[model samples]
Target: MFEISPTEWTAILLSLRVAIIATLVATPFGIALAWLLARRNFWGKSILDAAVHLPLVLPPVVTGYLLLLTLGRRGMVGAWLAENLGIVFAFRWTGAALACGVMSFPLLVRPIRLSIEAIDRRLEQASSTLGAAPWQVFATVTLPLALPGILAGMVLGFAKAIGEFGATITFVSNIPGETQTISSAIYSLIQTPDGDSAAGRLVLISIVIAMGALIASEWFARRATQRLHGN
Candidate 1:
């Protein structure tokens, strides 16, 4: 009853690939934005924060629709990129990754921002006073201290990406072997005859992956707290 067929395996592998690519590509941006939000107090900061977290509050379908309008084949930005750079997003696996990344970005940034905020400014100041350049201080002090949060955020974002349904499907249309993820595969399975068993198996897989990610997040959080407390 729990057997996973080759097609299901394909969906599973594709989901993993999309999630990984999304998380990796979004991490640096997450870190940079996190630092900005945590350390800076510029004009329109609140607006930027709200924009960053918009996906969290908006319906997934709405977010996906917005992405389509902005990045679709006929979209303003999309058309330009396709015409000049030959890059396409709509109806592609890369589109799925983009949707996942955008959807998971809020989750990716929050913990990182909190972690950066929790870091000791005095440590940074001391490093700077010791002739370390700004980049050196950030690399040696800020980044090390924020590693736990970054890992936690990445795990959270990855888990979210793996389960993403509405945005990814809306953007990429769930093409098998190209853009089909586990969630979309499960959705398709449940709509077909004799697909219950496959859907159930995928559901179990999703549960396991989510539980593992949460566990890993907890472990990282604990380690972060311990390190912060000098234990």
Candidate 2:
């Protein structure tokens, strides 16, 4: 009952690959946006925040369709990239990664924003008073203090990416050995004859991975809290 086939293994590996790439690629932007939301009050701040979080409120299929419209081969930016840079997103694994990253983006921002907000401004001010540049103060003070939240956000993004289906399928169309992630594979299995066993195995694997990520996030957060408290 627990035997996983080669196809299942492929799906598992692909899911991991997509989730890791999505999380890493999204981290820097997530941090920047979180910092902006938490610290800077500029024009259109509310609009930017709403845009970052629009995916959460929007249906996954709707998000995926929007990506298709903007990132598909014939899409404005997509066509330019394809013609100029030989890059394409439509019907490719990279597109799957893009979809996952966008879907998981909000998850990656919220915790980091909260962490940045919780940081005592005095610490940053002290660093600034000590002749540190703004970037240095952020690198030294803000980032270190917010590490736990960043880690948590990454894990959350990975989890969301691994489980993403609607957006990925809609954007990339579930091509095997390329865009077919575990969630998509499971979806295919459920629609196929005598695929129940295989789908069950994949479901179990998904559960294990998600649980492990959650556990790791909790541990990291707890450790960070302890360190912050000097305990």
Give the local distance difference test score of model 1. 0.95
Error of 2 at 184 (Å): 0.6
Per the 3 Å backbone cut-off, how many clashing residue pairs does candidate 2 have?
Answer: 0
Candidate 2 lDDT, 1-231, residue by residue in tens: 588899999999999999999999999999999999999989999999999999999999999999999889989888988999999999988999999999999999998998899888998999999999999999999999999999999999899999999989999998889999999999999999999999999999999999999998888788678756767
How far off is residue 106 in model 2, in Å? 0.2
Q: Candidate 1: deviation at residue 76, Å?
A: 0.7
Tell me model 2's lDDT, rounded to 2 decimals: 0.93
The residue ranges of model 1 lying beyond 4 angstroms of the native Cα positions read none
lDDT of each: 0.95, 0.93
